[model samples]
Target: MPDKQFAPGCGLVGTVKLLDIGVPTTNLGAVRCGEARAYAFWARNAVAPAAYQILGSELAKIESMGSYSCRNTVGTSGPVRLSGHATANAIDIGGFVLKDGRRITVLNDWASADPALRQFWDVIRRSACRRFGTVLTPDYNAAHRNHLHLEDDKAGFCR
Candidate 1:
């Protein structure tokens, strides 16, 4: 079933309905198994806002790198360890596709993307760090060489 939550009094926003909140979570110590209010709120406020502003009023869909992976960080060859996602404390954003049939992939587009697209992407990436406890980008490491990793890490690391 989908888990719907409100994004609070963020600037122009509505309820975020995460369809297929899918999979029961056993790693985050019973945070209701899906996106917690804070994470949802952060994503909506941090990422969604920029989506509309940057995608230009013609936004189509937001592509997700993925969420809720029951594994360890990439290149960690081992028995699956807990990922930030396991705690519902992380979100992986890959890219965006506009209504004009344009495919903007994070890996390829971030550097050479049009000025507007690059601005939009950078805005959101920086915004995520400002809003979330931790934000990882392609520059962070090979594990996240393609997507933005937004997490509510109490350590206050923004790399």
Candidate 2:
């Protein structure tokens, strides 16, 4: 467990608690996030198991676009709101690698012509919806065209 303090800017006003999931847990590699315990548990339990079931291979790594930033939500109109990343409570997953040397990326594989590839992304997205309160996929908007935004919030919004 690690804690980080950020200077006041970009909608961040105080010290932010963080957890680094950079160490390999199960077959997944580094993923830096704010909600470490919950995210790590979900990765090890829900994500890895689902990947094995769908891909018939052990998950090797989870490619992330990092986490914990002081920023506003993208592609939104109206008043700008602090992004979940502002407090280190969300992560953007861009892809995954499997032990069999297969790489699945949201940008390329989410709507892939291959049925198996499409199914894999669909299953993973649904699985993430079950655990993370907010799950935003490429389908959500063009701003999320290449990653799944999983946030530890109470929004109950998954798309």
Candidate 3:
């Protein structure tokens, strides 16, 4: 088991844990420190409004794809190198489900949803750009068609 954490900045406040923090690249996915901050921000800022707007309530929890990058997207056809997770700068967040039994998943219903949902997602995505150094969504490219990628790159660029 990894360290259990309760991050305050993350609206989650009391709900955070690490299954494993220092596992090897082969055993555990790469994760970064900056990415953790990005995730906390996403849960606190973006996920909250998106939930209240689309699901009719604030989200109870944030589903995450813990950060760390040992390598970039597969099939890029190049030599293997450091992934976003290695720097702990990028995180792949799946989505959030509200306390009211409503779900807001980036993969399942971000774009196909109704106007309120679309607006909610848009607002959150744009807001993330302000909090994170780089924010990428399904529209940024096919690479991010499945999840919301938030990062605090040293370069200070946003997607």
Best candidate according to lDDT: 2
Q: What are the per-residue Cα lDDT tens digits for candidate 3 across 1-159?
A: 232322321122122234433211112233444555555556665667667766588666666666643455432457754444445556777766677877567878767748887788778777788777767777777777777777766555555
lDDT score, candidate 2, position 117: 71
Which lDDT tens digits does candidate 2 get at residues 46-113? 66776788778988878878676778899899997888877667788888888899988888888888
Pick the winner on lDDT between candidates 1 and 3.
3
- Off-target runs (Cα >4 Å) in candidate 3 are 1-33, 73-81
The candidate scoring highest on TM-score is 2
Compose the digit string of candidate 1's lDDT tens values, residues 68-155.
Answer: 5445556556675556655445667777665677767778877774788778777877766666676787777787778777666555
Q: lDDT per model, in order?
A: 0.58, 0.72, 0.59
TM-score of each: 0.65, 0.80, 0.68
Question: Which runs of model 1 end up more than 4 angstroms from their true locations?
Answer: 1-17, 20-39, 42-49, 75-81
Candidate numbers sorted by TM-score from highest down: 2, 3, 1
Ranking by lDDT: 2, 3, 1
